[model samples]
Target: MLGSFRRRGCTCKKKRCTCGSMWYYRYDVTDPVTGKRKQKEAGGFATKPEAEEAAKNILAKLQNGTFIEEKDISFVAFTEQWKSIYEKSGKVKISTVDIRKAKLKIILKHFKEIKIKDITKLKYQEMLNSLFDKYAWKTICSVHETAGLIFRKAVELEVIATDITKGATVPKKQQTVEDLENGTEIPKYMEKEQLAKFLEIAQLFGNANDYPVFLTLAYTGLRGGELTALKWRDIDFKEQTISVTKTFYKKKEVKRTYILQPPKSKESKRIIDVDDKDKLVINTLRAHQAAQKVHDLKGDGNVFVNISQIKGQHLTTDDLSRRMKILLKLAELPSELTPHSLRHTHTSLCAEAGVSIDQIMQRLGHKDDQVTRNIYLHITKTRKKEASQKFADLMKSL
Candidate 1:
């Protein structure tokens, strides 16, 4: 016995009995909450003084409110609370929210069983390095970003004093040679003779309903989404301009369904001028529309609709791309070209024809001339040669 009890000296009748010489301490106190008596005993000390000192330290901690009860809370429980707070107040997109959930699952699977304070930078670095080895650099970066966000939230909520991942270093990613290879294979533009041949093939093998779609893409430089969302009311034949206001997004799971949304940016909402050649193409479209009218399959307000149906429903990017691929195969064109390459070709043509950078930027719905220039910088040498030749011609004329 230590506190609240006096030590008793041993006095045994037998030979050298030491009943009270062993070092042990026992104390009794009342539980504040339950009003029950409680006994605390600790021992294995070499001396009575050591036992008494230990007993005194325990008593001081209890009186000073420094004793901490071991908590049963876990990392998973805290993370769930963090997620509820994030969702209610965060402005995260749905796709981004889903990605965060996935990253959270990976973290919980690896570290949730441990106490939050027990996690160290070395442990987080090891996990990040392992994941980096198996995943792409972008994916690894996303994981790091998501983990940092969670840890930051933890710090804000006093769940941890410091984020263990804050100082962890991710290894530099190795890039494969195949990733550096230039994959663009489409020609910038068809020469006059090539254009003639392409048109001949289009007339011979392409469906009448599909030719205008291809023509529109080649001339206007509209993205596939923008082309899919074009309506008849958006075309101003008298002004020879086409208004690009909206685009179609094909949902990942539903292939046929299209969701109409605004253009990617304010610059993308533009009015593109129709050239004389494109006007002829538009006339062909109108003739086709009239022909469909006789069969009671006229489209609603859409400039381009399914030829076989009269519904106002629009085409999806995937279906349009598939149709264009079939047409390209039938015309004996290279299979590597996609519908998007048509817009590339349009930009290339504008650059080669000595169009002003500003005009090209506007026509392509680029936010600034630098965007147009950056994409077509490979043509700078060609432009230089053209400029030199033009200067020579000007001098000769003078």
Candidate 2:
């Protein structure tokens, strides 16, 4: 009685109604706990035996207690669950998590209501194309990557039978020559004569606030964040060194909010030695400190405060960039140079001076000597040739 099939004839003008047609199956099952009768219907079977076998298998699964009810959870529901689990694990940093959350919101706007199983590879591709049409290829790729991660978690949790996102393709972005050349090629360094002329003009700007900050970045090779986070405690006038401990970022959600965190790596946290060549800069900082002391009587202690708002906090990265732009214009320097370019200039100057790679690595807080070597390879070759020529000159004198 649990498995039964019914044959139905097509309404065709045939003599015996012997033409093969659709068949239907019906099965009855009882809940083991509740003793309630449940009926299941399946149709479109070509033969009676096939219909009976399907019904028999269903009855067997019901009797054995191995039948699992498929859940119809939507894509949005799974994403929320995944995000909650990911946040609780604390594997990702807050800033990175915030970025991922933003990207997920964009994805949820389109495919949130669809069930996980309903998402086919074709549907995934269409979503990617939509994202690509609206945003940059890089952004579309980021969304694709994040979506894949979400689907992978769903598969791990058995929410879906498989990850449908795996078969989807991401479009490749076109890159300009400048984009590829960046970081691989170092811009020309300031010649000794250019350095002298630039410093002369730099001394003329002469403001205690902007000029000092610019000089500090150029002389110490500190990042804008590291420089902004500097405090009086970080400076050791007696030892002529500065300790880099923290970096800063402005949260995009709350524009004015500043977050202070450690540097990107262990190597970023190190001491920078100040040499006698920078005695002029040291003297200038001392004068600025005296001025800051008078201003801090009102109780603000940020080292790089805006001079007008002495009571206000130090400058942000945007503020530094704006100030640098103004200074570059005044110094008759090209607009192409950025604050980070000063870091490159510092490395180039040291390499050209015949400084050893190990010492340069320590000075620049680079964890990998290979990275330092790679960046300064051209300078190293020039230094090698100069050294060889010097040896020849000494031999001729002998």
Candidate 3:
């Protein structure tokens, strides 16, 4: 359609004003979605040719079906909209949606209300690189994941032409010089000896449910969520293995109580063998089962159910952490250690005992995780040092 251009706020009274005010253009373009022609206008050109060139570019883009109408939406606002749409999509659990919301907050800190259309791949990478010093690699990755989803949805909605997160790189956090000198920073986990002491105190002073739960965690390396989802039927007392195929789900904001869902990933579904030689973990579980029988508290037969609570009251990962803290306080162990720390403990001790990393990965139901690999590497390195020291001692005797 033919369009018109003119200058605005010009005071010259001639048919053509020579006043140097900025130019504006008005044209009618078909709405790509509605197929209805609508008048659009833009201003702030310094000259007629510049304005005409801009109009021609817009017309060319529209003819090629590549025009993107500017939508006055902020990044944070669009992300919230996507978050809402995602929550209502029913593709994943509410708990997962909650996690996305948390990760999205980390991204929002860098791009609060910045226009979604304005973020290019370079800009996104800069934001990620800035996080390397402040956040752990996993946290940065999670933030990037959430950012990717938001941008994908933005692209799908035609808000932007390409996903800004597509080519962005997240820089891994590196160990500090002090960390190399003092050894890598210790993740929250107990040493083998410390775990023994913690379990001893748990068995001695803690409630009936405490020892078995922590012992199982330390021995099997089950995730806190996986443990909370365990049931009596999942345990094989005779075969001495525990099947893990599901996890506990919770979202307090949505009033979702504990529910059983599939394991976190396909690799998370596996069976873990109890130490059949010592029989401590299996016996502890057997004793726990017996006690439940005595109290007639076997409703639905969950393995990690808090028996001290009213019957059938389920245990969650949070509940396990709180109990672990109280027991740690009593045992004078590091209070910062969480129930998850037991999983790391299991990996470390297994590596020390000559269990191959591959076996440990399988037993722990992990495809691969950085923290798990770190524990394995650290323990294996220590073992290598011990081997060298022993050889030196033998040579000294010679």
Go through the candidates in order and give each one's C-alpha lDDT: 0.68, 0.73, 0.82
Clashing residue pairs in all predictions, respectively, total 1, 0, 0
Better of 1 and 3 by lDDT: 3
Residue 346 accuracy (lDDT) in model 2:
72
Q: How do all models score by TM-score?
A: 0.59, 0.65, 0.75
Top-scoring candidate (lDDT): 3
Q: lDDT tens string, model 2, 320-388?
A: 777767777877877877777676677777787777778777777777755457657967887778889
Model 2 worst lDDT window (10 residues): 183-192
Q: Which number leads on TM-score? A: 3
Candidate 1 residue pairs that clash: 232-303
2 against 3, candidate with superior lDDT: 3
Model 3 stretches astray by more than 4 angstroms:
1-29, 32-63, 66-77, 88-91, 106-137, 169-176, 252-256, 294-298, 309-311, 389-398
Task: Give the alpha carbon lDDT tens digit for every residue of 34-95 in model 1.
Answer: 98877754444545666677678667766877533222357787778878877777565344
Question: After superposition, which runs of candidate 2 have C-alpha atoms over 4 Å from their true positions?
Answer: 1-71, 81-91, 105-113, 117-145, 155-158, 161-199, 276-283, 297-300, 356-375, 384-398
> Model 1 reaches what TM-score against the true structure?
0.59
Clashing pairs in 3: none
